[model samples]
Target: MLKIQEIRELIKLIDKSSINEFKYENDGSKIVLKKNAGTAVSYQTEEVPVQPVVNQAPPAIESAPAAEPVKASPEVQQESKAAEEDSSLHKVVSPMVGTFYAASSPDDGPFVKPGDQVSKDSIVCIIEAMKLFNEIESEVNGEIVKVLVENGQLVEYGQPLFLVKAE
Candidate 1:
């Protein structure tokens, strides 16, 4: 088990570095910390095989140095709204932390793309971890609405790879 002071120190270190996520495991206890936008830090820990703890810090607000209100353009606002609407779709998530590949090989076409119909066993993408190529399957029958990640993007476990509209 990690002491509260030790966890605070680790959080400070992570805040000072460019690392967005960190994971530590020992003796069946595991801790995962992730940094997201808006200075919100989320953490999940499993102290025992059957018990888990999750914590999320309140979002922090920073005052603008110039005290000027910044506004997003209409196009940007529309895009953000679209993204929110797409959140209702089913997501095909990564099962492990790795580099995501859109195809089996460099020369091969992607396994699936936006608007492609996929069954429960369809291969959606490949993830390369520890020098092994792992084919990721879509466990839900649907039409792929969007490819969330680009080819060769680094993805964390449980990260959404593709959004699908269930049939």
Candidate 2:
């Protein structure tokens, strides 16, 4: 049987590698991992038999195809360049899989927007998971540089939802 830690390592390995899918089998257990077209990853593991799993080194990150260039308006281009050059920018990632909400309700304004100031513990957004609405906070003092996800969009765990330029 594969331990939980082993499974986590495999997940991290697969996420970093260029390969899109991975499979492994031992005893009566079978494991298959597949990455989605978006940022999410999913995997399946079957029942285990008697054999112990052996550990192996992680796979190296391979070079993938170059992406096509994106064209944008002049103002957007400047903002993108500035964001790329800023080293103090911090990404606020989702802690769990959920639908992203820019505000508490549809009629309410967003908790924060681009150029808005935020401090540690500020509730910048909400994540609805399993019927629970979780207020996501910014852990660093910063200015909201960008919002990566749209309201009412499904977000995966560890996906970056905002870019903040730390003060």
lDDT of 2 by residue, 1-167 (tens): 78889988988988898876677777656776666553233334454343432343345689877444334568765765667556778989899988889999999999999999999999999999889999999999989998877788788899777889898
| Tens-digit per-residue lDDT, 1-167, candidate 1 | 78789988998988888987787776656666677652343344454353322345675788656322234468755654475367568888899988889999999999999889999988999999889999999988989887767787788899777888888
| Native-referenced Cα lDDT, model 2 | 0.79
> Candidate 1, overall lDDT?
0.77
Q: What residue runs in model 1 are displaced by over 4 Å at the alpha carbon?
A: 1-81, 84-87
Best by lDDT: 2
Assess the local accuracy of residue 105 in candidate 1 as a C-alpha lDDT between 0 and 100.
Answer: 90
Instruction: Give the least accurate 10-residue stretch of model 2, judged by summed lDDT.
Output: 48-57
lDDT, candidate 1, at 16: 88
TM-score of every candidate relative to the true structure: 0.51, 0.51
